[model samples]
Every structure is written in structure tokens, then in C-alpha cells.
Target: MPRSPSLRLSVLPLLVSCLVASGALAREAGDTGLRLLHPFATPTPPGAPNGAAYIDITAGEEDVSLVGASSSVSEVVEIHDMSMEDGVMRMRRLERLDVAAGETLMMRPGGGEHLMLIGLEQSLQVGDRFPITLEFAERDSVTLEVQVREAGEEGQAAGQHGH
Candidate 1:
């Protein structure tokens, strides 16, 4: 028996949705309702002491706080923020970053909130992968892989979103 054309078309959308979801940078943090999206770090120069990483964090029913992060590539990972004040760029170390309920904290390069990988044990090259564990205040910790990519690389594919 041949399937109806309408049925085939309906299934095609579903299939496409699944494929897109699979490629999207959406990863839930345990049962805490925290989603980490598109975590990536830019390649570092040789013997560079520091590097930065960015990600998009979405909160669920309740607010969430990101206290700190840890990775083997760096000796210390600090939650930091970069902003322009008085026509000059300034960077500050944050003890914790808060994300409101049903809101997102989008960390990007060049400005805003970012993860500072200090005292790097090695220079991060393009295509290198590593794991970074995030600790949240009063919430379970989540470990996610970070992908190394060049600056301005908007990740939307499966491999670009990391492991």
C-alpha cells in the first residue's frame, strides 16, 4: 500500500526537526533544568597564558548561578565579564554569574560574560577538544566538552557544537 502524500510530507518535517535538534547546541545539566549551548573556545597562541571560552546558558523554572568551572587545559577557570566603561574596555572577575528564570546568559567573544582559562597548561589549537566541569551554586555540577574554533565561527553543525 502506498502512503498518502500528506503523510509523507508530515513525516518529512518531523525528520527535519530531529536532525536539527541533533545538530543544535542544547545540553541539559542533569535534572536542574539548566541548558548549556554552543560552548566553544578560540584558539590560543603558543605559550599563551590565558584563553577565553563562551557559551549560551538558559535557565528553566528557577534561576541559576554559575559559580566556577574547571578544565585540564587550564590550571584555573574563572567566570569573568568584559564591558566598555568610559569608552574603555574593562574586564572583571566575577564570583558568580546569575541567570534569571526563563532567561538566557549568552556569552560571546569580544565582550560580555566569558570563561577565563588562566594559567593554561597548554596552548589551545584549532580542532582541539577538552572537557570543562561547571559548578553551580546549590546545584549539581555539569561537565561539557569545549571545542576549539577560530574567532567568529558561529557553530550550528553537529561537530561544531563539541562532544
Candidate 2:
């Protein structure tokens, strides 16, 4: 069975919190077969990057891998994963993720899969937006401006790319 779109939309903020805290961000890209939902914020002790964007992706009708990511505000951007171990949660770097056609794959916080933006070059204030490029398996790509929100607010849902 498939999950409802609205239900998928609801968890975007919490995922955003996870991303921000972990150092990744996602802006509203309208919605794609694979979309980026929100930029969850992770807790930082001090002297951390300004902010990171979080996202949600719902693959519409094709299979793709979230191969690599790039952003101008940071030095390094890569796909990441946050998983559970014996009821313990942990985050790590992932090379890629497969998005099955018609499946609602979430790249939210606390999940086994996510994105990573390391070493910020700028400060992130509320209501800020930045640009990032996402590359897929078919050699196709798209660019989006990740919006920055408060530590708790969920980012706007991104739209699908192709039908």
C-alpha cells in the first residue's frame, strides 16, 4: 500500500529539524516524482555552520538514485543516512539512495537516509534561501533554492519534476 501525500507532507518539519541539526537543507522545489520536503535542524554546541536544508522526495514514475549534491554556501555536500540499531539511532554518510517509481521516499531527519552539508560559508537567518543542485542516476539534474526557517518550522514541500 502507498502512503497518503498529506501524511507525507506532515512530517516535513520534523525532518527539517533533523536536517538542520545534522547540517543539510532543502528548499521548496514545487514537487517532483522525487521531492525534498523540509530542512530539519540539528542541535549544535557552538561555532557550527549557519544552517542546513532538509527535504522530502516522492518518486513519481521512475527509478533514480540521489547520487550527489552541491551547494554554493558550503564546501562539501553529500547524501547521508540516519538509521537505527537495536532501538538506538545513528547517522552516517550514504553514497546513494534508490527511489522506486510511485513510492514516497522521504529524506527527512531521523530516517535512515538523508543529505549532508558540511562547513558553512555563510550564516543562516530565518527566512533565508540558498541554491543547491541535485544529480540523479539518469544523468539528469535539477537545482533548487533551499529555504531557511526557524529551528522548528517545517520547510515548504518540494514539487515533482516529471510526470
Q: Identify the candidate with maximal TM-score.
A: 1
Q: Could you give candidate 2's per-residue lDDT for residues 1-163 as a string of tens digits?
A: 8879998766765654554444443433324445554434334334676344565565765666778888887788877777787898876777887777777675555465656778877665566567777788764465655666554444233333221
Query: Cα RMSD (Å) between model 1 and the true structure?
Result: 9.5
Estimate the TM-score of every prediction: 0.78, 0.63
Overall local distance difference test of candidate 2? 0.60
Off by over 4 Å in 2: 1-46, 49-51, 86-88, 155-163
Worst 10 residues of 1 by lDDT: 154-163
**Model 1: per-residue lDDT, tens digit, 1-163?**
8878777655654543453345444665544477888778999989999999888899988899999999999999999999999999999999999999899888878899999999999999988888887898967666667789887564444245454
